[model samples]
Target: MIVIQAKLIFLNQQDKQIVLDLMRRWSSCMKFAYKRLLEGYDRKTLKRDLQGTFDLNSRYVDDAIMKARGVLESSRQLDNNPKKVIFGGRDLFGKLQKRHINGKEYQKLKTKWQERRKGNLYSRGDKSKKGNLNTRIEVKENGTFLRINVGERKYVYARIEAGYKKNKRREELLQEIAESNIPYSVELKLKNGNIYAYFAIEEEYPEIKITKEKGVIGIDINAHPGNISWTEVDEKGNLISYGNIPMPELASGSKDKKEYFRWQYAHEIVKIAKEKGKAIVIEKLDIKEKGKRGDFSGRKSRRIRHSFSYKSLLSKIKTLAKREGIEVIEVNPSYTSIIGMLKYAPQYMITKDVAAAYVIARRGLGLQEKIPDNYIKFLNALTVDELEELREHVKKTVRNKHIKKKHLREINKAMEFLQSLESKPGRVLEPLDGTSFSAYDFWRVLKVAVVTPLSPEKVKRDFSVLKELLIQGKWGGP
Candidate 1:
């Protein structure tokens, strides 16, 4: 759908403050009016009542309504829905003359309302409108105009600029986005900077996917992204290799909290998947297990398990999935990660060459059907392009997750620390949680099956010689 987002900037702080104060007062008056006047309470009649109540001179309430309507129509959601009315916070005091305003002289002592931060509340008996409440005003779809009277004069800063037509300016910009095109609920992010508005579009469907299965699909959710492992059985109920995908959190750190984009991201993906006829598979976490994420395991629980919002997100995803008649399976996660898809199967069960190739090849690719034997030769002969691209994608993805930019450097440094003990045949290394790694345990793990034996005495004797160079403060860096 055609979504229009606008950012309003007050020319100066004083003007901004003035506009903000006025909006607070007007918002209260507005709520009071609506609570009293809106009985039939439906949008069509509400817009008419609000527009007629406000004074208009040099006024253009109609313009704002028209702009919003224009967007709704292009989105094709305006049918039977009333248009929206939003009041952009205003500024413009020092720049104005009495004539420019409604000819009202500046009062000797005037009070204004301001916004409340934290947990402050706006009450009726306050000295000013109190800036205590910030309210969003809405009118049902008709793509109508909005008005605010400045002594009977109204101005429109944000309004519909274009509508879609065969030759319309906005038609090319829309690019097949419409309410009908998106058949389920999802969020669309249209942004400039600083200001973002969220619109919820929900379409109810009877089923999640067109697949023939009626049984549950098991999922294994993870710290970075979620993973699903479900056994697909044949008509005879024979087990099929489970399927899994790493579902990463879509929001980036540099984004402001107020932006709140991931709900929309998750919503959109589920919506599209449903439309494409795929059952949604997700993990059900035990409350206590999910709560203590930091205790998951040795390497992962300590280092990579801290991203929040996954628990809540899974709930929302499942709710939407159920609405679409999709089956969601929650399987016991024991032995899931360490023994996953045959391709990514760990070194103990699968040989090293096979495991390395699988991790490198399928890190970014999704679950897939088996490749023919000849395809392996084709992949082996393919230039180093594949590995390089895979690293680039992983680096970019991880960077956006807000992990410290120096993380890889630190990890490499730690690896070097462990490597030093390679000469110390029986030594082990173990980094504490948050530390790169400990020296004692990890070094021991590496001390095995050496084609050529190394001297343990070399490490005990020479390791102290390199300690200073090995560390960057308490953290290690190569």
Candidate 2:
């Protein structure tokens, strides 16, 4: 899908003011709907209440309620002490110009909000507003022209430019509309004393081929401002290409500069995919949820999380790729960082971020993630007698006066299991008391031994590597 915006070229100033008046009304409706949402009104109740509050049609009120709710939800997710979502009086115009809601248009607006700042509902602008009701714009295809509804009983007719024909080499909105069998969505926006109509053009493309012959480009998004690590892999998941694309500091300094940099970076990535004839693979992330729950811990973590616009980056790349007829694949993000750090990074002699990207690409290609040889070699070299000695050492280290009886029992059971496993190498031990000793548990034992004189730093490191390997599905079940 590609979006093309054309200036709404009203015949006179009176025609423009007529639409601006409706925008003000839209602003009022959004404020009203926002207040209702703050009072915890659900959609059903809000829709009913909006009918009595706003002098607009039921559909207009419904869309306003929806937009207001979205604004509040977005603010809460991004802001630590989020301010109330309010569209002020300085600018009260938007692109939501149709009565019936358009899914792609709504998504586009939502993306804009997601990419916006703490207190603002929309991107900060002198002429633009947050709650532009889209119900006012309507588009219909005439013989060789297009008719657009600007305001109440007002219409603007536009002729199709000769250059924007179906056989044109470039992707034009009119050409896409002519070829598309489905309905098209239109957006009306007020910017710098001009009315602009944006048309979302969806085109049908063939399904992307997912086979061993073609490779995948995996991208690992980082919180470090503008750092995008990527790797290309073949059908069997062998590494083909890998590099980090460094962007300028995406800090909260200048919005326009940041936007320009992001645009350039996304195109650079898309260019690589287009040239290589590969599918783009990215980790499916929910940064808002991660940030809200305090999952991203540490001092600089919050700053990094807030600053890094992973969603926006992905959104731009996806949009650009669609324009070029390229495919994008999203994969699960579990342990890509940890597994990358422990296994792929050192083995491939690349940064952990790049390694993670490589792993993500392999996952997209439906291949298994692997641990490094050095770690595997260390695990294979471990003797059963040595495990017994290590267990006994761990027991001695933890034999403190303050140690609880329950913990002692757990240690005893863990040690006994190790001894049993010495003789019964392939035996699958039953989970003890509805709990299991993961590789982390083994690492903890080694750590305890290290605290005493029983074990050394090298032993702890070796066991840590084994722990990671075990958790990574190296030895079957943890």
Candidate 3:
């Protein structure tokens, strides 16, 4: 389903005020629906009760109930606390919108709205004097055009115009509306003192069948701008092309500007996927949890998180892909960034963020887990606890010895090397820098007697070889 919005052109203020009055009346009806819901009334009972209170058309009252129910359902989904379930308010009903009506019923409703305006109850100044006794306005829809009952034949019965003129896009939109089989809903939004109508149109589309192609494109979504990354991989999970693409810097832009950029990035990503004949792969990220964490709990962090617009970007990509007959895949995000940073990043000589994308894409392609050679060997040679103990011992020894800053750097490097080995599957190494002490010295420092002593140099050299092997595996592809 898609919504097309157009500005309503008004030749006079009277027509505009008619729409405004209708909006106010609609809001009142929605609140009544909310009240019934809060009172624990069932849909049928609520509809029955609302019909007496709101003397508007049955369709208008029914639409308000539907919208109120939506508000309640959304609140329920957001929180379990009853106190948090917000009721229908002025903002929600400020724009008139209703969903799912039959064509014949809609036509009848339109005729009723126009005809009812002629009655004494809605007769101009009589409505002002009679107040609640006066008949209220109702919303109507016919395909892309929204019809408003303005009481006269030529006063305010014009169709809402979608004001898209650049490159004649408006014509195309009209054509699309004409071809649509089901126009789901119509909405009236008051923006900048103008009434804008939005039509949610749905057309029958062929089901998407995704066939494995040359490769998949992995997208890594991050909090910052210019850090969003994408990687193209062949069917066997070998990297074809990888790089970081700058997302719109939403942090420092106007709301409209930010929206434009967000769509721009989504469209560009989709275009690239289509051009390469690859399915788009992305991490299924939920930023709400992240935003609640200590690091991201600050106001700035919240803004940054909101700016990423992961959901919006995904929606746009999927919508465009559906039209283009491309497949989009979502993968579990667990440890993808870590794997990309520790192993794939170095091998592919790309940023860790991009490598994360590589991992995501490979996962979508159903590639086997890539393991570092050192991790496989370490998996057998030492337990996770033992590796952790060694890391601690190195850290304490360096602190106690008051080792020179330069030599201490080497110790930290060794710890980092150890950490890389542990990050692989079947091993969990606490991130630490190792001491310059070789395996022989390492054993001596801990006062352990062993039948064989391994040199620190030999161990470090071996680690280097394993790293190289892992990189080679990547180059060889699946």
Candidate 4:
């Protein structure tokens, strides 16, 4: 989809007033529909009620309901209270409530707030209606004009003042909309007392050039360290390239600036993928806001929630990939980090984040990771009593230190896994086959033996020494 923006110039004051009145009614209907939707009203009933109350046509009412539902859904996704949503600019609303400003400055703020709250109109496209019914653009030799249907036999024409000649893509799309029977949606907003139209048109997506059959570049996004790590792997799951994009400065910028940086980083990543001629494989993550109000959250949690936005960066990357005709594959994010930290990090002598990216790349190629024989030997060497003793030692260490509760739980889970392995016959346990002993089991045992006993700060930063411990079957640290 591509959006073309144009300024609308009205011929007379009467026509402008008519457009403003229509926008006011549309905003009212939208607010009503949103309130009713929150109160559990169905679409059919809301549509009927909106038309009756606002005296709008069926199409206008439907669009209003659609807009309202979109806003409600966005709020729900962000885990915000729908009742507390302020339709107008919330900052302006707060400023007015404080009553700090006076005279023209205060009046200007109030006017801007009112315009934002009530000066909007939306009309969906219909190919049957020659692109749009309520608001349609008509091309003429004189210039391009937007014909708005206000009521029964009522019409208003506004001239489009955009430089279509300067933009080849916009000019082509406009010509197509005028000549062909293509559908395009339009949204009009009153900004600073001028009408602006945003035209949304569907465009054909380019054919995918880079495909995963040859290779894939897997990405791992980290918020704590504020960096993105990626590993390129061939079809056989061998690493071809690896790198990291660090954006520590992104933590201290305005929202718009942060978004701009994200776009820049996304462009850089897609450029690399194009150069490598590989599809992009990213973890399908549903990252949520981490810090809670009035909770004793640490600096990492605060940084993750406030500074870095995983979804925003991921969205930018995916959007750029689509536009560039790059194939994108999403894999389950479960255990990618853990698998990387335990197996690939030490074995490949790489950072945990890069190891995770390597694991992601291999997983994207449908390859299964096998537990190292030394890790299995280390687990098999421990008896039930010895495993219980290790668990107790971890518990005591936790008491003396500040180990997270989740780590403690992981240690307990590993102890159970070891006890279950003891129940099997010596023959079945001798090889510790992949089918019987999974990667998850190995991860748990590593947590109990290596990760738990090591300093938390050291484990988070470096994993080079882990290779020696796992190879020598070292059960615990000094």
Off by over 4 Å in 1: 1-50, 53-261, 276-278, 290-304, 307-309, 338-478
Against the true structure, candidate 1 reaches a TM-score of 0.32
TM-score of 3: 0.46
Candidate 4 lDDT over 372-453, as tens digits, reads 7787777667666765665666666555344546465666777667776777778144335544556566676765666656
Candidate 4: give the clashing pairs: none
Better of 2 and 3 by TM-score: 3
TM-score-better candidate, 1 vs 4: 4
| Model 3 misplaced stretches (Cα beyond 4 Å) | 1-198, 287-307, 378-478
Candidate 3 or 1, higher lDDT: 3
Best by TM-score: 4
> After superposition, which runs of candidate 2 have C-alpha atoms over 4 Å from their true positions?
1-213, 291-304, 377-478
- Candidates ranked by lDDT: 4, 2, 3, 1
What is the C-alpha local distance difference test score of each model? 0.32, 0.55, 0.54, 0.79
Candidate 3 lDDT, tens digit per residue, 264-353? 577788888878888888766555544435677644456446565666566666656766677888788766765665566656567667
Tell me the lDDT of model 1 at 56.
22
- C-alpha positional error of residue 277 in candidate 1 after TM-score superposition, expressed in Å: 3.4
Cα lDDT of model 1 by residue, 1-478, tens digit: 3343323333345543443444443444344333433233444454555555543211122232333344444445535322232222123233232354333333311111122111111111111321111211112122211111233333322222234343332321211122123321111111221212222233345654533253323233344333322333332332333444434433344221211333343455456446545444454455445233455643433323355445545655565566566655443333223223222332123322222223322221223323223322332232333324433444655533433333333334434544553434543222444544442323222221110012211111122222232221121222
Which RMSD values do the candidates have, in order?
Answer: 19.0, 19.5, 17.8, 16.6
